[model samples]
Target chain A: MHELGIVFEIQKRLLAFAAGNGLSPASIASVVVEVGEASTVIPKYLLECWPAAMDGTDMEDATLEVEVIVAQVQCKKCGTVYPYLEHDKICPSCGAWECRMVTGQEFNIKEILVYEEDVPEDGSLGGDPAVR
Target chain B: MVKVYEIKQRVLANNDSEADALRSELKQERKFLLNLMSSPGSGKTSVLMKTIALLKDDLKIGVMEADIDSAVDAQTIATTGAKVVQLHTGGMCHLDAGMTRQGLEALDTDGLDLAILENVGNLVCPAEFDTGAVKNAMILSVPEGDDKPLKYPLMFTICSVLLINKIDVLPYFDFDLDLCIGRVKELNPDITVIPVSAKTGEGIDEWAAWLKNEVTAWRDTSSSETIIAKNKEYDK
Candidate 1:
């Protein structure tokens, strides 16, 4: 349910971003979102809801690209930071139980891909002026 | 040609900022807000009711019960004579910071000592969003098994306190309290895990007293002097 909610939120931001950047909505090719390993958003569910979330929006045809962020935990007592899934929050070096997450909770719109603007070939360079 | 612009913005940025505002506002008012999370059927509502029933007389308490549907829990809290409100999430599984702030605003906190936000019962997603409460707690019942910390480690990691509810059923269930504690403490060394049974009131006093202590500590730390100091920073 939160995935769909996130989808809708992304749609709003993408649309506003498109407008604010003075870019046409048609130029947007894909919206890349990073799904952290421990984040609430389920990428598969978010993609499932994307079509519905984008319905009638300017980004209706924009595909969503998901990037996964691996969870990393930093042990407070020993100052060891490591992948959480690997160590399960225990510092391998010091065996400390107190760890705070430094990453893997992020849910972010990582990037937006758009069609590059077509360059007009008729534009003359400094050496290709009318005199040339 | 295709161009990629790196946005690198948090998907829940709106909620995050709103949560910050709510956190500061609650602090300024010298009130304590607790966000309680648990899996459905973990007795979240029952624990809340018991806490409110035991603490309402000593503290000006308010509660916000959020469910996808039904006002049943709200009805239960109302009987305790505390200010209560029920929020229907319209099928939303979680309540974000903005939604929580709205609920608190509606609960009439003008002289309230403490407020509890009983989040929708779902262990996974609710732990992901910061609801801007001063303290966060979760309930794990004996029937849910001790493997939860290993299975859903994120929830165990995020909570400040863990309530192992339905302890009265410990005799019936094959729950090993030591194994559960060991697992959770491994994940969160600083967590305060309180074993309680809301049904039999076995540890309700301890739970209520913990809440009172937290509330008092929060209030005492953010006295008028601290607010003035904060105001000075704003002015500067």
Candidate 2:
């Protein structure tokens, strides 16, 4: 499935991101991703492939967090904004045929949740990183 | 220790940039790339074969058939005497812009004025991907019914040309052509719809003439700056 291919691409990029941040892959608790509603990506398939793609890798136990961005379209003639699928391009208000897509079609890594230990101002050997 | 990192990076940034780069390369090479996407059994090969027959004398043509398995389509296209190559997606449903680049490299593009990528058959995935083509064209056969535009609006939305294939079967199939074209135009304000049938060779000349015009126009404006002109529509 294409989603599996996309999963591998995301995983590869995530590993690079983790390395750039000087953090071990295991330090990532979850990788949050935002997928557009109109993007042809099936979230269910992506979730199904995530664990399989991460197996035996540094992110083996990491969770895959998904966020769906809704598709929005604005009518160029009527200046009305609505769901892209609802009206596509024809404005529901003025019956115009021109519109601009404002959102959706996005696929990106939004954030990375990491597990880390906090150190005290004195550089204590045993300070819980969670304890700011 | 735990902290969150905000790395808001596009997952397909590599694909977008690669597609842009490929666009520039195609312009520099004087190649007019056209990606054809349609559902399986939509006569994409038939249309392309007919196109080859019609334009072989006037234009140098090359084709790349993308499929998950088998080289049947590529073999069929090869019979037309045009330079052709087959691309295997290794189970991927769609060919991303990166994959299309690999296919271009494999095909003999030297002195070819028109190169067409018969993209994987599935309508949904192909529309979501950009193959760095100067123009995007898709085919919708009459047998598929007119309701397809409602179901697969994204395909109709992104395509600049919608080839309504199998018009010969219009009487056999209950297809409303006007309704279909109207729905498609609503999604894409600037789409040119051509009704044709590869079986009867009806409307093939018009399609060929359209291709000739587009090909020469692409070559005339071949430049790195105008390579991504279509994308500039969104930048506004």
lDDT of each: 0.81, 0.83
State residue B101's C-alpha deviation in candidate 1, in Å: 1.8
Score candidate 1 by TM-score against the native.
0.82
Tens-digit per-residue lDDT, B22-63, candidate 1: 878888888889999999999998998888888888899989
Query: In model 1, which regions exceed 4 Å deviation?
Result: A19-26, A70-105, A116-132, B223-236
Per-residue lDDT tens digits for candidate 2, residues B115-151, read 9999999888787667788888899999999989878
Candidate 2 chain B: 10-residue stretch with minimal lDDT: B227-236
Please list, in the order the candidates appear, how each scores on TM-score for chain B only: 0.91, 0.94
Return the top candidate by TM-score.
Answer: 2
Off by over 4 Å in 2: A72-102, A117-132, B222-227, B232-236
Cα error, candidate 2, residue B228 (Å): 1.2
Report lDDT (Cα) of residue B197, candidate 1: 96
Judged by lDDT, which candidate is best?
Answer: 2
